[model samples]
Target: MTVGFVMLCHTALDRAAQVARHWATHGCPVVVHVDKRVKRKGYDRLVQALGDLGNVRFSGRHACEWGTWGIVAATQEASSIMLREFPQVRHVYLASGSCLPLRPVAELVRYLDARPRVDFIESVTTEDVGWTIGGLNLERFTMRFPFSWRKHRRLFDGYVKLQRRIGLKRRIPAGIVPHLGSQWWCLTRQTLSAILDNPERAEIDRYFRRVWIPDESYFQTLVRQVSDQVESRSLTLSKFDFQGKPHIFYDDHLQILRRSDCFVARKIWPHADRLYASFLSDDPSAQATAEPNPGKIDRLFARAVERRTKGRAGLYMQSRHPNENWENGRTAAPYSVFEGFSDLFENFETWLGKATGTRVHGHLFAPDRVQFAGGDSVYNGALCDSAAMRDYNPKSFLTSLIWNTRGERQCFQFGPGDSQKLIYFMAADANAQISVISGAWAIPLFHSNRNFGDIRREAAQLQKIEAEFLTVLRASWVKARVRTWTLAEFIENPMEPLQTIVDEISPRSLRRLSEAPRLADLTGFGQFLQNLRNQGMQPVLMGDFPATGAMPQPGNRRGRPYLVK
Candidate 1:
């Protein structure tokens, strides 16, 4: 596994040369891009220092600027040079001049060899996390100003305010979801090639030219679109202070830097000669160990994982008719309801898995329908088959069993070998109320506007059905836990309800409840509620109480429904 370095540097020629020489010593090719703004003497110094390093080369200089397209342009130039000069390189790492190698270069190469397909990059949708300096706003993308805006800050600020006041904003291009991330990353050759070869490469470049801090988002957004191999985590260790500038490594931070799993650490001060000398020590043992033990950070990470997954209750949401076009009722152009749910569930499961080191299964009803966009099955033939649920290994992280409400009754039988802990999620929205009253049978006609009626009338009918259902559950002695939550609440902030549900259903002590009835053995819902109440547990309503305004009003369309098939 050949590794290449694309280092972008403007200052500290000596430090930049040291980084290049260090990596080159490990048989890695290094491509350096010195900012055009740097003095000619600085560039000459860098070249002279690295003249003996056969694997190191320099790209054409560009005037790199912070928080502008210039940084990305420099990166592209350096990466292109590396790809051309060293065609045998399998992976290219992007780093700044101040970044220092934290671990042995050989160890990093070995780690990459094992996970050849995974791209080490950090990324988040712009809408989800927003920009780093300030929260997300339209001004970042809409305002087109010169890079000199930094010099004439007041003028640029006033210009942006004026544009916003006049309602000037650029619409994000269709088929593109803006994403933002750290500028530093380690990418595979395939990912780099894909980014360079993207058909929309020119369009993307033009759009980002006016964006503030385009370097952070440009490669991140494009890489995500082109590669599913992304690991969503950067291999570089960088900590930002309150001002959002990266913390410069000092001698005091030696231990922390040495213990980190990251291959590199950033913003090393050029004047910290002692720190640099310590890092550049000739003795292998003086540097970071080849396989460093997990320190406090590892334990902290484990604790975080346990908090999210250990004993967490699974939430299963059921819809009568599943379709591809059922996202937040706004982005219904591409994804169906099933696709949207699958994506949400997959993200949730991924979060749990990463935190807990356990696999969380998503049991989607009629997998064939979801996969092929085929016809939906009314009955859940999968749930009725107990062997299928047993095979899911519920002892790990929670199982999110998604299916239509038709066969929900059969799901009561689902449990681990001896555990009876189960939580049923009931939607408290108007649409759910309508579904409960009309059942799946009337859904098609309802969607076609045939059975539509007054919102208050349908709501009242739904309340009656809910009361009756709860009454039946209370009387039946069921063993599983049941909770009511609205879709809006779940979508708005899932962590709150998820944590509550997990706390409710999780075992309170090390000792198992000997008298707890098995889920499959419970004859009615009453048995479960009674057993739960006997154990001092009460029924849970996981989300916020629905406001009266949340109730559906007359003439308000529920949502466009897609064919189940």
Candidate 2:
């Protein structure tokens, strides 16, 4: 008792003829059903191509639109012809035009023969169906879908909402539980005949005609009513992405398809000559004796889906830049943002890079141009010093920088003087390590040698921006590791905060910092704040500074080493 195939052909008639010939030559009956939308010439050509094979027959044509009932009617007509024309068939396998046999037909026949009574179909209840997309699960069966979802999407959506608002729901036929699954299935002859010849066939058909995408649920639900030995799984290997679109196999997926050991696979690229030639050839290789375990390649498909949807962390490519907050990560790796550090220290970027073995830069968001390390005009990933381009999408620029240089740690100086657009974004990112010394921006103004009036006004603006930025860092949603110290408090004992920051950046290094980045000459800097206040700009962020600024020493000194015995 050989198996029969019911092929639903729409596009790629030549490829369908090839697969039909392949199956017919292997002593399997094939019933081809072409979609009615195909032109007359293409239909006649397909008919003539397979005319020599007596085991192959053409079923009546039907206009099969996606997510519509015409496909189910076509499948039913083709399945009926398959059962009547082939008496020796014990199983009928439903396949699409794009399907190709991955294993020998004899192995599939043998596999079915071993399980003569079991039917292979993915039948699951709505509550258990986790893979259903389009937000219509139980509603698919309960509501009337008169409008085509593809051609009349607005009407379809509006009708669904109207039904929901009016509490309108159709009554399911008696003695049949609604089930959903992949449309492709392999059914035992007994089960297929029982479903086709059921006494209530007309009533069942009427109930399913208005059901949304009933082809997937028509046979899937009826077989449950007639057959007791259902396997609740399909023998065909098919995969869908997160959006419920099938993944088409190409030439490069030859090895991936072979590893599945599945008898048949669908949605193959017609242009994949290598895959067709390799699988369809009669090479004398050992027969695949393993069970049809598509799970072997499930991990590979899952990863493909993930890469398409979430993508690699911190990567902002043109192909798949996710919507805001939908990214897998804000940045690929952990990096440090030093606020006020540059203003308080001399050559702070160089000192931090040397201390933690990280790539350090100055005022990446500076107005004129990006201050890349060593003042280069260009950096990795072709990121240039174009302030206009960087300002256009600062978040993308930052994420691309981290993604391009992922293996190394990155440190950059940020201050109120730079763009504040990325403040909220960086504060929310878990990979950011921010160190802030409040009130340090005044140092640059103090030493600017500008008139006191201009310095006071600029200081007020910078102070306002910094205060708003600090509020965001202190927000509950901030995920980055943050440490904020007033200028006076930090200068009093700078080594402790410096040590903590370095340890976090390079946790594997166990050595304490032997020296610190040189502090800017803060002598009389306390007078700077007092001056701001006298000019009516209150500098409260700087913790109580002494009227006479005194630079705090490292506090303790290491004695000269003594030789041990």
Candidate 3:
């Protein structure tokens, strides 16, 4: 797997030369793009350092500016030159002059080799809640700004305010949803070719030319349209503060950097000569060793097991009503309980299962008895009316155990057996959901608004409970040789932490679970509710039981199932 590096640089030519030499030593070709703003003397010095390297090539200079379209242009030019010059290269990594490799080049090559079709690009939808940069997504695309705005900030500020005041908004070009991410990426040759050879490339280029800070968005949005093999993570590890400026790596950060899985870390200060020397050295110790840590290796095995067992396992989930409001008569919304578990199960059998090729037979059980009560009682609460419980097919051996006060304790007997694995899933947000439900259900005379501090304290207590639950579950599972998982982790990626469990138990075959039906069939209640929405009905049966609304008839070609009375 031959890899190529495209280094974009303005200053620190000496540092860039060091990086190029290091990469070249691994038989990887380097394509350097120097900004046209570099003075002739500096340009000559850069050439003098890199000219002797047989594998290094330089692209035509562009007058690159920070956060502008010029940066995109520079990268495109360098990538184009690299692809044309070295047709044998399989993957191309985009980096900057001051960035240093975190792992050995051989290890990085192997990592890429393992996933040749995947593009290591960190991308998120532009409107994501966590992307909290002030006016960046809005102003960058909407306002027409020049590169000189940095020098004449006040003038640009006034212009932006005036544009927003007048209700001026630029429409993003057709067929593009805005995506923002780190500009650095490692892309496969197929993806690169698709990007370079796109039919609408000219239109895209013209549109982004007027966009502010297009470098971070341009390639990110466009490449995603071409390939679904994109991994929403960058191979470069970078940290930015509140203002979005990258943190400069210092000598003190060496250990932290060494531990990262990232191929590179960037924005090294020019004064760190010793640090630069360490990266440029030929000694093996200079590069982070690729030896697998025992803890990490264990986790890898668990993930492998998770991937292997997906879609074919049996899931036994036991959830208690959030303990915070147990004394209060207020109960969780019947639909919320149905929806949350439906989502959890649907994701398990459908999204996560299909994504990992594992399907699970889900059996959910919620106890009927009130907390602190000693005797058996009917579960006449919202759970009884929940579609999740009512629609479970007992004949299929799929069970939803409600109305039994001792069910949760008794269900532990149905642990992993006969080559099948059991995963226990619970929601971390159960307490918060219960709190909101209780507050909403409060009588008008007794209602009291919770302050932010109160909410924070409650949340902290809930999180502690959640953590302790996991810790105890983990210990019990370790002792019993069964697996335990959280709803949040399953929804996100269950494979991440499995390696440690796998390491400890060292199962003969990591594979667990059996082939099962599709998720659409498994989540019958969810699909029934969704069909209700499709028919323009508001299906709200909050305090009511048995979901006695008009259920769609089964075998409806539209894929809607009728609710049985």
Candidate closest to the true structure, highest lDDT: 2
What order do candidates take by lDDT, descending? Answer: 2, 1, 3
Residue-wise lDDT of candidate 1 within 355-388, one digit each (tens)?
3333333332222221111122322324332434
TM-score of each: 0.51, 0.94, 0.51
lDDT tens digits, residue span 1-565, model 3: 6899999999888888888889997899999999999998998888888888888999989988775678898999899988998998899999999898777788788878888898988778867737446566756776777535677788777877888899888777788877888888899888988888899899888888978778788878888888879987788866664456676878866655666545787878877777677656667676665532223333433554444333122222222132332221121111011112222223322332333332222223322212111222323232332334433522112222222222221111111111111112222211111101111111111123556344434434433433443343344322222233322222233233323222222334465434322222222333433443454533332111123433223232322111111
Worst ten-residue run, lDDT, model 2? 556-565
* Model 1 steric clash total: 23
Question: What overall lDDT goes with each candidate model?
Answer: 0.56, 0.89, 0.56
**Candidate 2 residue-wise lDDT, 1-565, digit = tens:** 9999999999999999999999999999999999999999999999999999999999999999999999999989999999998999999999999999998888899899999989999999988999988889999999999999999999999999999999999999889799999999999999999999999999999999999999889999999988889998888999998989999999999988889888899899999998888878776273366788999999998898889877788876566564667788889999999999999989998888888888799999999999999999999999999999999999989988898888998899999999999999999999998888888998888788899999989989999999999888888888988888888778777777888888999999977988788988878878878888899999888777866665544345421211111
Decide which is better by lDDT, 1 or 2: 2
Indicate the TM-score of model 3: 0.51
